[model samples]
Target: MTRMPRRSVALAAAVAVLATACSAGGGAPKPKQIATGYTATPQQTGAPKDGGTITVALTPGLSPNYIYPYPPAAANGTVIGRGQMWRSLYRPSGEGDQVADAELSLAEPPAFSPDRKTVTIKMKDYKWSTGTPVTADDVVFSLALLKAALKESPANWSFYTPGQFPDGVSAEATAPDTLTLKLETAYNPSYLLSMLTLLYVMPSAEWNIAETGGEHLDFKDPKNAKAIYNYLTEQSAEQSTFATNPLWQVVNGPYKLKSFDPTTGSFSLVPNENYSGPGDSRLDQVDFKAFTSAAAVLNQFKAGTLTVGTLDSSYVTQIDELKAKGYSVYGAPAPARFDALTINFANTVDNFDKVIAQPYVRQALQRLIDQNGYIASRGIYNGAGSPNYSTAGSGSPYPPAFGDTPPYPYDPAAAEKLLTGNGWKVVPNGVTTCENPGTGAGQCGAGIEKGQKISFTLASANTPAYVGARDVAFSSAAKKLGIEVKIVTKALNYMYANYGNTFAPATKNEWAMQDFGPLYLAAGYPSSNTVFNADGSFNLGSYRNAEVDKLINESTFGADEKTLSAEVTRLAEDLPVLFFPTPHTLVVVKDTLSGPQSSFNALLSYLYSPEQWYFHS
Candidate 1:
């Protein structure tokens, strides 16, 4: 499909976040206070009974828009359907490990050749709704389309690095059920497997045509592949036809697109009777109801109209009220995810690019985030957030020392000093202005002129509630350092679609900072290829550092497996984006509904397993 810089990221999980943190001070490290109140997989009660529709509440403003696997924006930018209508070749792990789920995966674990230059994948015993075996041909067709889309634009897939992946590799269905890729260079098993997780196998027999109702052609031909990519993308764009299109009905996943509301982006899914995977379709259908506002979702929960959904941290205090309504409230920091205020270095508004380009300035801005305070503040995370310092949030096997100990912990006094040291005249209650113009140790960085103000808008998502609450908290903290931090609230979808500087250059100056929630890397291997590489498609802020790039390369290519953690540690200290506490997403699911606990794990991206769920007594 489309791509991530070197890794794949879905532009979602704006699900409420929480984290763990150590104090900023030099003394004995403050006890690591990551709240443990919320569990990812709470024990389900009751015996299963078959066939009931589960009306799930889609995150407000974060409904399905693009139906194609290759998302065009932030979240490599947003994948439509996987684990539902279509299944990825390798399923991301729900347990937050750096591996695929064997039971749900469409293929066996990849077997790498001795030199690690080749990968062989065997298809599982699965078939499409049309009774055709899910084979290597489908995988080949999918990758061909992915390559064709990437040729059109890297925006089609955020995880792609220009010379990596489908670029030099040759893929084919060696056997009817076996797919092999002969890579020009060796790659880490984890990294390669993670990439495969985004490769959603489509019904090749039905979708291989270049035109509507056209004859199927050999997709192996580059021209035919390109035409097929164009045709599928064109169909995906017509959201109204998502359910009715005959081409969309030949599914292999547990659920199939039943109906779609072009308006509100809500849709219905029915059981795919021919889904050849673990678990039965105990639920009759699933209605994903979308909302214009988070408040509307909250109202739905209050009215008991929402059977399963996530509640923002701002509404966690209403747990008892929700409990009275038979909903189980559980929350946790999503695995392989980190929440942060993505600093847009391209936004030249108020000389923000020049000002923020300085290492000291970014450090100062990061120092203003009161992670513990946010957890302690009822207005924000309300004890639900755990401070996270690295891109590989909590529970990741490889978080640098800085992961637990923030390099720039909350300190308003330290922030002011950093500005003053950088030749800025600090005003406690007024706007701070640059007093030095040179690119020296005692002067503001290069291109920054005297009297320049450190001011930029922090575009925050209005849904998750904590996104706004925390951004406001940061804005207020910046005021103390003479930095003008303006908080502008926007919908998650608008920010996810329009806030990226790399994709939407026209709106480059619209926002200097955006907290559209966390960016999830490939399961198990959280590489920062596209997200941090200078030439990365998902490097929205245009963060560039030669050393950082080297580290990412070494991890992704070099034999030193430990290099990945080193890369993360370096990013933590470097401050590519201002780090925030990872808050626990408070899920409110009616206790009467039960399923595999792994299905609700937030770290697994937008994947959900409703097929395993059913209303029980």
Candidate 2:
């Protein structure tokens, strides 16, 4: 989680929100024409004639698990999904590369210590919709809310808590709009610094009431804790409902929530004419529609009624057809996202614990699959790209890191040898089994109930990535290793819910291997806390690697740059998860849309800069 400076740090965290923008370290290459018979020239600048409304139909499930800075509802920086409704101090440049100048969000530029250990941010002379000036108290309240929620909500903080400043962190307001933060130690500070961009400034007025009476609520206090938690939860669930409270003050962003119709799944935003910013607020209406099915979205696009659709390999062929029909199709290669086959070595599949525990098995699986073949079939590297094991690639997927060679070449011969040397004898029937006659009741080896067969389940998206050609290509390559894999397709939402954690007792016991995406956060590297720790909430396979656990946990409390990168790479090489190629972000937009750069390093968001986009017409 590198902290993005006003102009220094890259937009690493922001890009992570989108599936396709996941990068390694450096930024992705600039967008170039994809030879779809359309030359994309840059749009002219300073052309602001904001009047028309932009209607966008986004994929469902953009809302985060939590919002606000309270127990249960706190520290879930995933709340960043709420950015469509709120604006941060700094924003991504139109190119989607890095943070540019502050619009009306910040009063002045953020002040950093000479060593960059401390950053002082001054609030812009802005008000909430209610007209009260935003203040330092709001910032302090937001931080305190996160700190308190993290301290109280163990369930939510199962992964690392969000908005962690530094070892020794303190905040103070020098003036009404001036707030400063002091850090204990400094490395690249960007991990913590970028968090500020995700911080949704709260109203100090409400916070003062919440924290009253010198009688602060503690997690230890049953009555006080319950009351506080309830209060925060209620507030989070009603953010839009309270948008118009006279006590509520709205910051000067491009748009403000004018109305919300949750039933119809439509929300409207009116421009804040009282404020002055870089881009003119012209759109009179903003409608957000959530589609239940990708087909519905595509049909809407076909009908010329929808503005956007999330294009992946499943639609690449169709998109090409659309291009032939004169529709402008844009595709950006995402940074490597490291889709992996994680082994829950902690849970004994049978008597084969020692065999599966061996790192050789993990390495064997990595070699068995061909990343380049998979990417080509998935249209992952349609433009110019190479296979990468890391989210950022060896460095940045776009510009890419300077002087870093690819790790883990595709090698099947070496893989067989690694397994054979580990004591698993390759039988004539193509089933490799451990050297054992009989176990207690169950059996040993890769197959179910017996060491004779190599069987595993690959749970993936029911949509195109998993059910379509990509899964076929993946399964075909895996089959070459004498491995029998069951491709299980679950709905995308169900996949996130069940695979994010372990399967329950009620579900049929069939899944073993999953070609799933990583549970990455602002911290660019992976952490065992989310999916590896023995007690981790998301440890679906019940993986309990003590050494891996120690390494991952240590990286978070603050590991040096080299240490962090090494730790990330070590876990990667060790094959805690069999890494796979990430998909490219292909978006089709109206020609007038400028500043629509996509990232390969981070998550993607549809509402990243909904306010900044203006029409050429």
Candidate 3:
């Protein structure tokens, strides 16, 4: 008998910070402000009742791509929609705690080999909607197909490196219900299990058409790999009509797509009677409707048309009005996400590389940022936010002891002193110019030429009314320290494209800093390896530090929390990215709905436990 590892049980704390509440009129009283690190519990107004339709409002639009959970480009709606049909090996127990416990969904908790190189997973006795039994072979086939698709989309398989599949790691069916995975590398058992949370099982019989002529098609073969990937991706994309698609009709989860309208971004889901999951869905029907703006969603909530909706910081002031209208509001700080001002270290224009590279300069900038003031200005509900000093952000799975303490207080005088002492002439509320250029004390740092001015362009997404206010505050604060900050607002897509692109010598420097969040996803295990590593794929700022790189790499495979905490502490001190207030996720639900639990997986919304939700009548 294989003993369950302690690390595996500790995985229960994997739920990251991510939540909602309402008030009556009288100019809508100030929304209750909650501090950071608070975990939201599901709203309990009444006992669960069966057979009711809950209409959920989503902003922007539903995903155009078919609801394929594995693809990196999968939309938020697609992920939620896929969750309704496809079942993962483990599911978050909807208990409304800060740390969520992983319960068996389709398979039992995996048993590990003594050497920790192998994981044995046993499939639960479950059947798909098509009356097909979910077996170990299905798990093997799903892993094989994902391994093949990795070449086509590296982001989809971010946990592993190129050519690591089938060689560094391999999976096989040892028994009809038992699947075993062997890894060439000895990784942290906890980290490995966290990564498996992302692995969603697909039907082998439905998706295995790529294998032709009875010959094993090696995904390593470029031509064959491309063909197979295209075939799978296209099938997922073409699933426009949910009811007509034979492939989508067969699901293992509690709900199935009853109707989908791609144009309006509206869809309806009905309970899957054949689902073999832990609990039965109480709702008879679920509808997802798209809204163009946050105000629209709020209006729908006030009208009692939407059972659930999200409120941005702009709407925080309206908490009373929502409550007056009879909506329950809930709020909590996001766990994996935080907004920050990211400086481009690779930017060579205007001596940006020289100025931003200095620790003193970055520290001075940190001192100028009033995170608490920014939160107040936004009327951020429920004290729902807090200053994020490290890349790990608030609500991380790691211990608080590992997080960094704020080194710089909000003091413009101190900021000016730091700059002036460094041989930069102080010009309060204006651009400061370098007076001395040398490595010696009281001289501008190396590579910074005399007369170089402290100035840079900052870009941010146009939406969210608070971003503009935050930009203004940042600019005003920098001005007091003689820094010239030009704020530019652009479409979120344009901002993301420019901000996220890797630095190139031939490319023109677009913006020096970007304001966005919560930057990293908790699914990656709160490790700095993927976001802060010198060679990280998502290291948009091109910030590189040898010490940081080493710590992050070690933390990726380090089993102990001590190792991980050390890395977080180091990053907090280094200030690779300027910290900002973590935005709180506020969700509004109708009094009629019950069992609306939060999950680290869906940080921005309350769609984690739709199956458990029901209308109280």
Supply candidate 2's per-residue lDDT for 419.
56
Candidate 3 residues lying further than 4 Å off, grouped into runs, are 1-47, 60-64, 72-80, 92-100, 153-167, 211-226, 239-243, 378-383, 395-397, 400-404, 502-508, 523-525, 596-607
lDDT of each: 0.77, 0.48, 0.64
**Top model by TM-score, which number?**
1
Ranking by lDDT, best first?
Answer: 1, 3, 2
TM-score of 3: 0.85
Q: Give lDDT for model 3.
A: 0.64
Q: Model 1 segments beyond 4 Å from truth?
A: 1-40, 71-80, 602-605
Worst 10 residues of 3 by lDDT: 1-10
Per-residue alpha-carbon lDDT of candidate 1 for residues 92-141, written as tens digits (9 for 90 to 100): 77555665788889999999888998889899999999988999999989
| Greater-lDDT candidate between 2 and 3 | 3
Which of candidates 1 and 2 reaches a greater lDDT?
1
* Residue-by-residue lDDT tens digits, candidate 2, 173-286: 777778888776542443443445556666555444333233444332435444554565655555455345332224345556565544444555666655444554556766
TM-scores, all candidates, are 0.91, 0.73, 0.85
